[model samples]
Target: MARTRLLFACLALATPLVPATATAAPLPASGLVLSVRQEMGTFSTTQLSCEPAGGLHKNAKEACAGLAPVEGDFTKMSPGDAMCTMELNPTKATLRGKWRGKKVDFQEVFSNPCVMHVNTGKVFEF
Candidate 1:
């Protein structure tokens, strides 16, 4: 009975030392934010930060890698021939964020999702 009482006292004292609310560390500096809009008007968003890429993008790693070479310049990216149908479908993509510490804002329209995927690499494959 004495040991149980002592144990209860210890737990009671320690409980007060613990915080009722816990806090999480702040999010790291986000380097990039990308938005993709398909021809049908549906859209998706993603983010890439400092080094590790994240968010809802299908190929965050590949997208980030593709962005690095162009430093976020949409025009500089090569639009490879994606062997898509001759349809004139269009898709638009936009990005606003920092790249290697420099502010970046980019927007471009591709012939179609297939063309965009092949030309833009994974940057628009969300």
Candidate 2:
């Protein structure tokens, strides 16, 4: 009985010294963030420097961009028979692709303020 009591007392004393751990809340589906370092394109490439916002940029100043869930969830993006064609310009970037028999277009209204040279009319098959 005495040994058991001593163990209980030691446990009680040590309990106060234990640090509390913080639990982080999960990200929302509509606002999910993807930290993409660069345009995940063809197998081989040199490098390009740009970054995106929305808490998904790994390195905002070093070729890190983000994919945010605006109209759809990230899980909804399945890897299938889809072809993405990009058009690069001095002022804008346009992306058009066909996924699941539906045509989709994404336009980047704002160009990279730092001005990274991106190739135009490149088709990436995912």
Candidate 3:
């Protein structure tokens, strides 16, 4: 009886507790994996989170905030309205993460860092 009680207690402890006032729709998971290859030929990988404000990103909070609006879609983050210079600078980016329990895989190439920064905001600033 004691062993059974202990097992039950352990199982209870392991269970995640949902808030009583949770939103009607489930929110996305708060994690991201980003890879960026800059125009200067340097590469960097960043991890980010929205809730905890933690990650490898130079501006973790701002990066996560920037990511939240686009719902983890790199294609959506691209700003077509940006008026960038004619320079041939290029940057490659990849992003993989979970949002609303769905898998996201995105890859993109920016014509220049100016375009990248204008469009992507703080997401790839690191």
Winning candidate number (lDDT): 3
Candidate 1 per-residue C-alpha lDDT over 1-126 given as tens digits, one digit per residue, 9 for 90 to 100: 964564455334322232447565434343566667778766666555535665556687888788777877755888776488867778887777666667778888877778777778877776
Candidate 3: list runs displaced more than 4 Å: 1-28, 78-83
The window of 10 residues in a row where model 3 has the poorest summed lDDT is 7-16
lDDT of each: 0.66, 0.27, 0.68
Ranking by TM-score: 1, 3, 2
lDDT of 3 by residue, 24-43 (tens): 55333666667777777776
RMSD of each: 16.1, 19.5, 11.7
Question: Which predicted model would earn the best TM-score?
Answer: 1
Selected candidate, larger lDDT, 1 vs 2: 1
Error of 2 at 46 (Å): 13
Q: Model 3 misses residue 110 by how many Å?
A: 0.9
- Clash pairs detected, candidate 1: 80-119
Error of 3 at 21 (Å): 29
Model 3 clash pairs are 28-100
lDDT of 3: 0.68
